[model samples]
Target: MVQRRYSGRMDERFEIFLACAPGLETTLVGEAKAAGFGPLRPDAGGVAFDGGWPDVWRANLVLRGAARVLARIGGFPAVHLAQLDKRARKFPWGEVLRPDQGVRVEAISRKSRIYHGGAARERVERAISETLGAPVSDDGVRLLVRIEENLVSFSVDTSGEPLHRRGHKEEVGKAPMRETLAAMFLRECGYTGEEPVIDPMCGSGTFVLEAAEIAMGLLPGRTRRFDFERLASFDAAAWEAMKRGAARRETGLLFRGYDRDAGAVRMAGANAQRAGVDGTAVFACQPVSALERPEGEPGLVIVNPPWGARIGKPGPLHALHRSLGDVLKERFRGWRVGLVTPEAGLARATGLPFLPPGPPVAHGSLKIRLYRTNPL
Candidate 1:
């Protein structure tokens, strides 16, 4: 499903799908429900809902846990490529894209007779190009066509760049967590911006920054320009008004981050500044053992320590985990703890009372599991 991030006097209703990290569907659905959405059902890495263009715009702008927002264009039975072509030709491509704007088509076929994906794409491209006089290309205004079990569906991408690039992080450290992943991890930990949040191993300050932004009620897409602006019905005035509304809301302080590496600490500071959350977030350069719990009542402490794959050998890293757990138990008994790691054995060595670990979230080849502990 391609993201539909447009606004205007067109259709008031659409089928919107939210893409999320695996094992986080329940979390995302909960978020949507809390945000006054749903009757949502669980699906692979996403939650589907019915809404209009306003909801679509709002989702991309405010959703902290979604990877992307796809709008369903149309779907139909396609026994062969010709059927796909006919259905695609009848679609309202002209409403979304201008004749001067170039379009790209991508197709995938499975469990059906229409196996030639390249040929299917070509047919779709020709249909739109010849019928609507819209030019076709390998780039720009991507229209993703998915064919499975002899069924064909079409959608236009409304999010030009992936939602992860929130235009905030100018400098990122090695193995830095993406902003979306950071937000999702924080949500999984039941963060609601009321208490002080700490990230002891905050490489590049992603987790800390996301927490700060959430506390402030800042729209994640405010600082960045979206591809939706280029669509046919984009209401610049409304979008600007929405941006102003978000900016007018003052952001609060409920977040801090610490990294033992001075270089990472400095990078985190720079990223925070770029993200406009520097004033609300505090970054400290100190070892995990020396890092003190936030000076308040019981809050939340989330960490992303360097596993053996990114920075060090398993022996030293295991010792680090043990030291972290020891410090948490000794100094911060009332605080909840959430840990993100690639190794379950090492996570267990932390000695935290985490339940069954979460399913793996794909970060390239490295699948990570999130483990959490109760606030004792």
Candidate 2:
């Protein structure tokens, strides 16, 4: 695994944006910085950093919180459809796109003279086909076109699938928390992989497995493929070396998860095994009331419980929250808690002293928030 040094030249560098759930921008920024990403700039929905192609690969391969990584290829002012088509044709698609591979162009316009999204998309698609001789398909590499105030920018979705699909965790429970979101929430709770984590309502053991992997220094995208692999600029040898050179450490602490459903426990255990964290992650089937603190120092107890958005009714959920709060207070003293839900009232039902929560994050159609409590 030879370390190929990249001369950070201006021509070789480009702007890369790591998209995340809206409210978790700060947490994602911290994770990105820790992963040696950049001098970062945090925005509404993501964090921006400057790097070359290798940085793009590292981001997709190692970032635990980003939903997708987008590379800003080029931008110019296009007031009308003809100008957009001309500029798009002149853009260097061959540098990033292969002739045999297909592409899907998506366009969005806001406060711009060329305001028709469909027309913009059509022009971009035609330009790509005419200029690069590439076929267009729905499942091809995604190219995004943003025409805002007559300025058009082109970006390619480097991450084909969402980062949450880590090429493992085949089984999922109802309304399961995405692995990306789980990782960000863990970071928001001040988790640094030095303490044990418990997800009492662990649906498919996302939090527990992610914690174990972090503690062991496993790469999130180790088993996954990216859209960059299809690009013309992809370097197979360098990428193989990067993957082979990922550092893996050992931890004595065990991350634990509990679910009332026997099937969920089995699924979680299987997912952990596939993630190569089975030795450090433990999953069991048991009700929350039966949860007892493991023998060790106090750690974090995080749960993404049913929020009544798609699951149970609000009344029973209130009781469930109350019971969870009671159990934690009575038995799990000195342990911190991080609870995620959509309703403030439901979070209040827990009766745990929570600090001011961050902004609401868009998850599907619903907005969720994280409520953190000091050590009890």
Candidate 3:
């Protein structure tokens, strides 16, 4: 197969935003910087960069920390509905949006005279529908119109689905970790896919799978299709060539995942198979007490143990946390640890020498933090 370099530039440049969990913007910055995306500006919930369509495609293809990618197309200041409608009609809609493909327009107003978001959305939707002859559908290219202080801006969701949905993991356990979050967590622990990784309570094997994929040089978006493909600016042949240009490499290390439930182990194995990283990852049905260090290398042991809010009685949970700490302290010498929990008390029960916790990240309704330790 011929590996061609893709240089598919859009007609216009864009301000690309890579969205992530609020606390993870810096960690995302690290990953993006390592991937050669530079001059990064980190915002509250994401990072922004200047690039063309090729950068958007590459960001969707490789940036594991981004929840979704948004392209700032264009916008204007409109004080009222009539002005908004008139301005929206004059803006060029045919540049990036396809008339044949459908579109979905959504609007939000904050401290703007156009207090009614529904009315604003209808106005823009009507303009696109009438101007480009594009049909309005519930499931279509998402056009987000932000009306802030009477200035309305348009952004297109280039990633149709969240990047966390890597198109694998057909089966997930209760409180399963998302691939994007798991990737960020792994990076925060300084894994870099260069060393072995162990997830003791590896529900559905998110960390191990992500580790294996990274080590094997697999692209996250390889198995999935992005929403950017639907836009008029998309180039299918170029995208196909870009996907083909990636080559997988061999790795000597093995990513290990253990779960107490036999069903979870089976599910994880199947998920790894689907992700094409099964060859480099190993999964087993085992308790934390049964976890022993693997030979040949001292790597990182990261776990998202079940928290008190998630399940079971507190006493047993505390003991479980204590036992996890004891096992790591007594056995896994020289291996760093990254533990995620909802409470500091549970982390303290582990008795490991932990550094300060990172900012609390929202995982569902409960907030969680990652507590790290130097090699013990």
Candidate 2: minimum summed lDDT over ten consecutive residues — where?
1-10
Highest lDDT against the true fold, candidate: 2
Query: How would you encode candidate 1's per-residue C-alpha lDDT over 290-347 as one tens digit per residue?
Result: 9776566788898888888987899988889998888988888899999999999789
Q: What is the Cα-based TM-score of model 1?
A: 0.92
- The lowest-lDDT stretch of 10 consecutive residues in candidate 3 is 1-10
Clashes of each: 1, 1, 0
Cα displacement (angstroms), candidate 1, residue 332, comes to: 1.3
Q: Which stretches of candidate 2 lie over 4 Å from their true place?
A: 1-11
For all predicted structures, in order, the TM-scores are: 0.92, 0.95, 0.96
- Model 1, stretches more than 4 Å misplaced? 1-11, 247-254
Candidate 3 TM-score, C-alpha based = 0.96
Name the lDDT value of residue 152 in candidate 2.
Answer: 88
Ranking by TM-score: 3, 2, 1
lDDT of 2 by residue, 283-342 (tens): 989998999998999999999999999999999999999999999998899999999999
Q: After superposition, how far is residue 243 of candidate 1 from its true place, in Å?
A: 2.6
Clashing pairs in 2: 334-376
